[model samples]
Target: MWRDEAATWQVAQRSTAEIWHLLANVDVVHGLYYLLMHVLFTCFGPGTTTLRLPSVLATAVAAACVAVIGRRVAGSWAGLAAGLAFGLLPAVQFHLQEGRSYALVAAGAAISTLFLTTVLQRPARTRHWAAYSTTVLLTGLLHWLSLMILAAHLATLLWTRAGRAVLARWAAAAGCAVAGVLPLIVFSRGQSVQVAWIPPLTWHMLIGPAVLLAIGGTCALPDRPRAGRLSAATVGLPLLAVPQLGLIALSLLQPVFLDRYVLYSMLGLALLIGAAVGAAVRAARPRFPTASRWILPVTLAVAMSALLPQSLATRSPASRVDDVLAIASDIRHLKRPGNAVLFVPPLRRDVKSLTPDAFAGLRDIALAVPPEKSGTLRGVETAPDRIRAALLAEQRVLLVTDASPGARPARGARDRMKTAVLHRYFVPVADEQTRGRRVIVYERRSTPR
Candidate 1:
């Protein structure tokens, strides 16, 4: 959670030119989002709440857009229900508190889809088409993968038998979005190593999509003869199915099936569920009118109750695999002044950057240059010889590693050297383990073995 968010904050803290340079090299996919956060940090100053506020606001906007979409496709009751469902979604709630671009990307997806609907409904409206294209372009800029939603939209348009002119316009807008994002896509491809941590598709990876399909299928059972020209099934089903199935299929060739990547698809599920509930309530009103009034409330209450534990848990630090703030706090409490610190594997430099205040008292022995000076996230580490020399020079060393108990030893020469020197020259004094993080302290022995 904060691990990725902290990286984004660090990027935003750099100068505009530096951020642009970093984006071109490493995170070009989120270039627009970094620029937006950079402007926000400049105006508001930086803090945890300040960093996450934009995402919260974006989530609210996404909920509103979901409501609008529901209203256009279903009715007022469905719109309200959909909005509430969107807000209550666990994934949506989790991202709302994060400092990353996912929430904004979700919002952009919803807004762009809303515009796409308008374009389809009024095929002759040039302004609507322009707005749709512009929104698509902007959403693609925010997150290149978000353009995957266009495939779902394409399927929707084709299934609905949209006019040839409408289909052509939709294709043109999608093409414009792809053209606009091509540079980012190309640059990001070079940085593909960034997401190498994503594992190949597994049965576990299908759980989320399966659960969503189950819920959507259950909701789809109820008949809504008057659902509207763009029925909930037409829009919601594809939005839920295409991106997920497409990602899963692509993951067979290359690993890239992360649920957060398609978090916006939940809006489609919510819309369909909302439409079903509203339709059922309306259909029941003619019979047992008194009980029909309670149907919507009862359904909503049950859904929220089922999600309550997860929603509450999501707000806690423990919900995340690694909490950088907690890790930094523990390190601060355990560390002594002037102690040398080594981040095993070297990529964990963002942990220190995230909690600068907590790590300010410790010295990073391997760092030859600061991140700002070197224009790199982890900064430039000293040579292996210098690192070993610096470790030998220290009386006390703090080793922060991402390794677990059964994990393989460090592969890099510098990492291996650090471990070898520590184990060979020093004795372990303290050890602590948190999710995905390990901190150990070693003291110089009176006589080296």
Candidate 2:
């Protein structure tokens, strides 16, 4: 949760005057998260809570945005219900605290959407065009898929004859997008997902998780028609969100895709679900005050139930940045003067997964290490060759990794590493929990066979 934020904090500490140049010239390679964090850390100070405070605040604001947008598109009653549903969703809260851009993306997407609809309802004018264009531009910078909202806006604009001029403004928006993204395109050329990963996309990787997310979030659509156009919105939000999931499933064919990367569509999905529920209750009884209250409370309860399980489950246990001190602790206890640590399989340059941040259990442990020994890029056992070479030059390695890829580390990576190549390897000193995941302390095999 904090790795992405901490990495950005590295940049935020620079003098504010130098920040713009830093954002433009430096290749943080983190999508646009570094730049956004610059703004957050500027206000909140460079601590973990401060760095991530924006995401938290953004999502809280987003729930209100959803309700406001819902009231406009659905009805006041449906809007209140939708707002509650969005606020209570554990997924919303989960993203809000992280350093990643997903929560902001969700909020930005919602606000932009509301702007789009309001503009469309009235005659086209330069003022509406400018507002719509600005929202579209901001959305583009927030997340990769936030452009989907722009696409949605365009789709909405096209529904009427008045939409032609507003829709045509996309040419200008496209140019701005290009100019904004050109630097990323140039710097990230070699670093794009295509060059970095090995896995191929699978159905489960794409549609499966998104479908589950959607179902978990908004499966509460009501069966009523008077809930003020909710049935249409309920239908439309899914239609917009589904394509992004397909793109994600496709993206797994490349090197990386964080769930945060695809989080923009969730706002629309959440609001629609709320509307669906309100529409249903309203349908059963057109009268507002009596039935409406029950519908929203029920929807919120269900969304909460769905969100809780996912929140507990997906937070990877081995995320190392969160437990760096623990890993360092295990090392300290088992350490001899000469013992050294190795990042197994060597970390990929600028790769989040390639570093100690990957291990949730060892997160604080790694963070607590002295600056010199703390951030070294050594590989844990099953250590990659390059990183291994770095460590072999030293004597010991407090190796770690959950290389199993969604599977826990098997029985003993220390033993396996000893067998695989480091014949002189021994599980002489260490802790082993699930496979290679837990820290292992080792003294080279006492004697070469």
Candidate 3:
């Protein structure tokens, strides 16, 4: 999305500054993120791999950062576990496969939070302060949502340490942050859309992050809590699990809630919980055997890891690069000017249509509605009247219906395109198949004599 949309916007505007001009008012703070991504993609050359390269490298670098920070917080063993766990996380794995900035957001958020914590705990550390400021500013520029993570970091910093130190550092950082981000702050005032939600913390949601954290955090947490079983379970499981639960609930209603965005929050909770459990276990000999403490955490981790889906439902092939290339080639060959492309009933959210996904590849092919916007355009056209109103412009109208043959709207949409109401407007030319998925193509029929 970042690649295709930014590529189109930048091409239309012709310069980085112009790209900023178009988006700054529209996306507000998020415009800066697209602006920066625009600069990099231009330099790297326009393609998904080129566009998303920075995020891949950033994820690798973030894993390394985790290890370094973990060692500082706990010990070498804990650092290794934390780094490895983050790299292998199911959420991280999913985001890494996409050509988006979320992975970089995870990296920047994690590194910045580490700096904020370090500076708060050891107030006199100037180096950590400088580093914290840089990452926080960069993260804000990278994504507006990064601000939320920064808010959580600042809250934790103020709450964790006592009066003068916490107040002083937070004030200084907040001032710097605001001054640097004045541009986005001014722009994001009116255009944004929001979805409200009631938080859901269910059993399935808790299982994964909780188990991973307990396993990874064990190395760092103190030994006394570590000795017994109950201490480990309580600290290790719920601490990390809770935030993931919050995220999962948010995601269902608003699909915008991606897994990687709150990964830093998960790690923070995990470390605290694991340390508590380890400490309690060491305090006394428990009813269960000494091995049971280790045994249970290990068992849960293995089971949970197995359950998380490694391959998400892709709109195309599971291999994102191959899928994009395949679609792009198809667009180059099949799409031509004067060929009217229609997006009827927009593609279903659950079902990924090849048309929108392959739009960027079509070069100059005029479309019914641009691919990036197919969803919104479809949503806006409610009844048959609205769909009919939108259809009058194109000589050829292509209907994008869900694959379910039994759905009422899908049948209606197909029927409408068949020319029951507008007899002279369209004729079916071809039916394109994408990996067993279907996209029907149509052209305008001649007007009656």
Candidate 4:
């Protein structure tokens, strides 16, 4: 998790103007988050705690908002149960420590939905609608994909048949949000290459939404006629279904179905589960008053026990696809002053950017310009001929590459040359592999003849 956190930290390390320039061309979706982290880094200095604190706090606020939604739609017991269930969610816990926009996006979704509920319930307050629109706009600024939550809100409004007046207000608010996000959408489109790695919809993607619906349906079954069930289904069902399904559907044309993108949807599941548990407890009270009193406590205890392993695993380095801190430590131990480093694809140079301090003693032999100077994350690389010459000239070269199985098979002319140079002039001296990356040291076998 913190492996990707380095990208956030790298953006934070730049000057505000530099960050703004970088965002104009790429990463516009996370522009607002980087700005917020810039302020945090300025005040607290860039440490793991400072980097991740906002996400933790945002998660706490989102959990509180879920409780409020549960109370409004169901009851006090439902609210408590919903909030507790939210905190125990594996997805929620995973993003809490991440220094990214996902947690903030989830928080924005919760708060904006809370406001949407108020506007629907009252249907007269212009201010409520304004607040809702503003929150939606802000959420989109944090991460444009969060606007998907508005589709769920639209579905909920339509399902409830919340009078023409309420529907009109929601439409107006949603239009304003769309307008607010238009510029970012345009800029992000220019950077569409970022999401190219998203695979097409799979059985797992289909199963995720189906499982959520099953849980919600089970909850709704127990109290079909109750206002609580109706409200929960109206709001929760779409929130759990639409974002994922919409993304999956769109993935056929363009891939974007990532679980973290819709992490907020879990709030809907929690609300339904909480309402069902509360209903079950009430239904059992008359038959077994003593056991009914124990229901909430026992349920929470059991839930926590089930979630304990996942929560603990979330803190381990293995939980992340890569661990920048661990990689940095390895580089520190293995590298000597003036050692030359080569990122196989050149883009892999980002690994050094993540742990700049550890790489201070080393030199990027193929770098033609620094990242800040080039206005790119990985920086510009030297020409292919220059890279080959540089590699041959070095006594020891550190090769960094993706940890994937196919990484050794050269995929492009540049990579082929890199492999050829390494094999023709050098011998492997040492190697280390991590979850996300591989590091190998090659020593000159003989003088370049």
lDDT of 1 by residue, 387-441 (tens): 9999999999988877475345687788999999998999999988776677889
TM-score ranking of the models: 4, 1, 2, 3
> Which tens-of-lDDT digit does each residue in 320-349 have in candidate 3?
322213333444455565444444334331
Task: Give the per-residue lDDT of model 4 (tens digit) for 105-179.
Answer: 999999998997777666468888888999999999998888889899988877777778777888999999989
- The C-alpha RMSD in Å for every predicted model, in order, reads 2.3, 6.6, 7.9, 2.3
Error of 4 at 23 (Å): 1.3
TM-score of each: 0.93, 0.72, 0.63, 0.94
**Model 3: residues with Cα > 4 Å off, grouped in runs:** 1-14, 120-123, 158-160, 182-186, 194-263, 269-316, 319-338, 344-429, 433-438, 443-449
Residue 164, model 1: Cα distance from true site in angstroms: 0.5
Backbone clashes, each candidate:
0, 50, 17, 0
Q: Per-residue lDDT tens digits of candidate 2, residues 21-76?
A: 44343333443666667676677766768767778788877788778877776777
Worst 10 residues of 1 by lDDT: 220-229
The deviation in Å at residue 75 for candidate 2 is 0.5
Regions of candidate 1 where Cα sits further than 4 Å from its true position: 223-228, 403-409, 434-436
Candidate 4 achieves a global lDDT of 0.82
Residue 342's C-alpha lDDT in candidate 3?
A: 40
